[model samples]
Target: MKNTPIGRLRLIGLLEGISYLVLLFIAMPLKYFAGFPVAVSISGALHGLLFVLFCLAILHVMFVHRWSIFRGFWAFVSSLIPFGTFVLDKQLRREEA
Candidate 1:
């Protein structure tokens, strides 16, 4: 597959989604339910890295897709919120497709 702007953004979105799921479904639950915080600790670390990559991908798309500063800023901010990455993924996919 071509490494287009949309493709790269989609990959970032997928990674972010996985990270969120790990943090929420696996980590948070394990922390609260099973009384095992290890999942949260590990997933949180991975999420941190994914978050950075997501930020970079957003910056790249800001130029590659000619997104406005406001749009890019909001999009990047959205990733910090739980489940926001999924919404962003949908929006970006719609625009790209």
Candidate 2:
């Protein structure tokens, strides 16, 4: 899956999505409820990196595949919502196949 641009994008998207979830569900709670600011600090940093990578990967795939703006927009949007990337992955898998 790492061999192709779309595959790489899919992988990055999944990673980014998971990181976002961790930051929201686990890290934030740890910071506010448990008084563990470090959890948010670490998870936030990782999620930021992953989010950048995900955007770059999306650009790379868009250029490589010559995808339409709407498609790229959806790809970008998918990274924002919880479990959104998983739903996007289903469509991406169809394209890959």
Candidate 3:
């Protein structure tokens, strides 16, 4: 899947989504309820790195596919919402097929 621009974007988006979820559900809870600030520190850093990669992947795909600005904007917006990337994955998979 990594051979093509869309494929790479999908893979990075999935990873970024999972990292965001981990940071939100596990790391944040650990920081607040379990008195483990390190959990957030680690997961937050991972999520941040993945998010930057995701942005770069989006740009790569946008340029390769000639996506409309609105489509690119939607892609960026999807990264902000929980589970949004999974939903975006469905659309991307259709495009891939």
Best candidate, TM-score: 3
Quantify all predictions' global Cα lDDT against the true fold.
0.83, 0.92, 0.92
**For model 1, how does the per-residue alpha-carbon lDDT over 1-97 read when each residue is reduced to its tens digit?**
1387767877887788789888988889889999999888899999888888888888898898789999998888778777887888878777876
| Model 2 worst lDDT run, 10 consecutive residues | 1-10
Expressed as tens digits, the lDDT of each residue in 1-97 for candidate 3 is: 5468889889999999999999999999999999999999999999999999999989998999999999998998899999999999899999998
Better of 1 and 3 by lDDT: 3
Colliding residue pairs in candidate 2: none
Global Cα RMSD, each model: 1.8, 0.8, 0.8
The TM-score, computed over Cα atoms with residue i paired to residue i, of candidate 2 is 0.96
lDDT of 3: 0.92
In order of appearance, the predictions have TM-scores of: 0.84, 0.96, 0.97
Model 3 misplacement above 4 A: none
lDDT of 2 by residue, 1-97 (tens): 6479999988998899899999999999999999999999999999999999999999998999999999999999999989999899889989988
> Is 1 or 2 the stronger prediction by TM-score?
2
